[model samples]
Target: MLIDWFTVGAQALNFLILVWLMKRFLYKPILHAIDEREKRIVAELANADAKKAEAQKESNEFQHKNEEFDQQRAALLSKATDEAKAERQRLLDEARKAAVALSFKRQETLRNDAHNLNQAIRRKTQQEVFAIARKALMDLAATSLEERMSEVFTRRLREMDDTIKEGLADALKTASDPVLVRSAFDLPAEQRTAIQNAINETFSAEIHVRFETAPDLISGIELTTNGQKVAWSIADYLTSMEKGVDEILKEKDKPIAKDEPKPEEPKPETKS
Candidate 1:
């Protein structure tokens, strides 16, 4: 092998030039394209990671907000339920109170009506009983009773005041005819004679005597003259008793009026 330094050197120089040109053109351009692609890939990866992190954070926040909404809705439903229960209870209490008041009023009205009805029935029963008893006693005393009653009548006439005798005398003298004397029972001959003598002693006249019996007078004597009747009777006494009973019933009907004092009955006249 003969050494060719010049040729070898020239060839080596040519190769070095080619390598420099390739490095300046193709190799440098390709390396720069690769570097730009790597940079773009890295930037894309960073953008994707940031988007994933943001999505995760948003998901967590959404879940937390959903929980809060659910809690609020539950609380609202519970509050509404409680309010409804309270309202129902209040209405029930009001209804019960109204019912109690209405019941009390009804009971009061019934009591008053019952009391009034009882009073009316009692009064009607008393009146009927008294009437029946009076009728029974009067029927029992209708007959031989009249004979025994004459002595009692004579004593009552004599017990009358002297003014009564004087009035009888004056009335008999003024009479145009014999005065008709009416009585509850037929006057006995002796009693009639006594009455005529008493009258004649005061008036000095012969007065004709006429006697009649009227059962309705009970026990009484009536002297009729000039269409005027001056009479005394057991009927009058019974009338006064009836008036007293009526006053008692009226007082009982009005409680306020009962507080007032009652008037005293007039005293009987003294026959001196």
Candidate 2:
């Protein structure tokens, strides 16, 4: 190989100058543009990550809100259901009470009606019995009623005990007005005289006597003086009967107790 040092040296110097110019202008500019692009890409990637994170946070918040809304809705539904159930129970209780009250009222009305009917029947029976008794007595004693009654009055006066005699005597002595003798029928002169004599003998006192007929006495005699009265009447027996009838009817109207045992009737003895 021929040694050409000057030509080679000149070629080598020109090659170095070209490389320096390329590095200073093209390479450096290209490297800087690439670095800037890389930096921009990195910044964009970071921004995207941050945006994704924010989006994820927003999604989580939305999910939590949804859960909270669901819970509120469930609570509202439960509360509404409870309120409805409570209202229904309240109405049912009221209805039951109303029904019970109505039933009790009806029972009371029925009992009252029964009691009234029993009373009406009792009154009618009492009136009929009284009418029959009055008619029988009137028919049997038409002629001798007054005489028998006067004799009975005199007998009763004579039969007075010492206590009654003393009371009558005191009343006769204290009374400023005449003693009154009341009867259902007018007495004849003889009967009046007998009655006056009986009273005078019973009291052992001379007393003024006044006789009066009172139809309301109803086959009875009454002696009155100084607000004291001695009386006997058929009405007394009727009143006693009425009281007994009332007691029996009241017992019949009363309801029997469920727990109470009924009395058994006695059986007649059988012949052997």
Give the alpha carbon lDDT tens digit for every residue of 75-153 in model 2: 9999999999999999999999999999999989987887787667656765676567556757887646566667778
lDDT of 1: 0.72
Error of 2 at 263 (Å): 19
Flag regions of model 2 displaced more than 4 Å.
1-142, 188-190, 255-272
TM-score of each: 0.35, 0.45
Clashes of 2: 0
RMSD of every candidate to native, in Å, equals 18.1, 10.2
- Structure candidate 1, residue pairs in collision: none
For all candidates in order, the CA lDDT equals 0.72, 0.84
Clashing pairs in 2: none
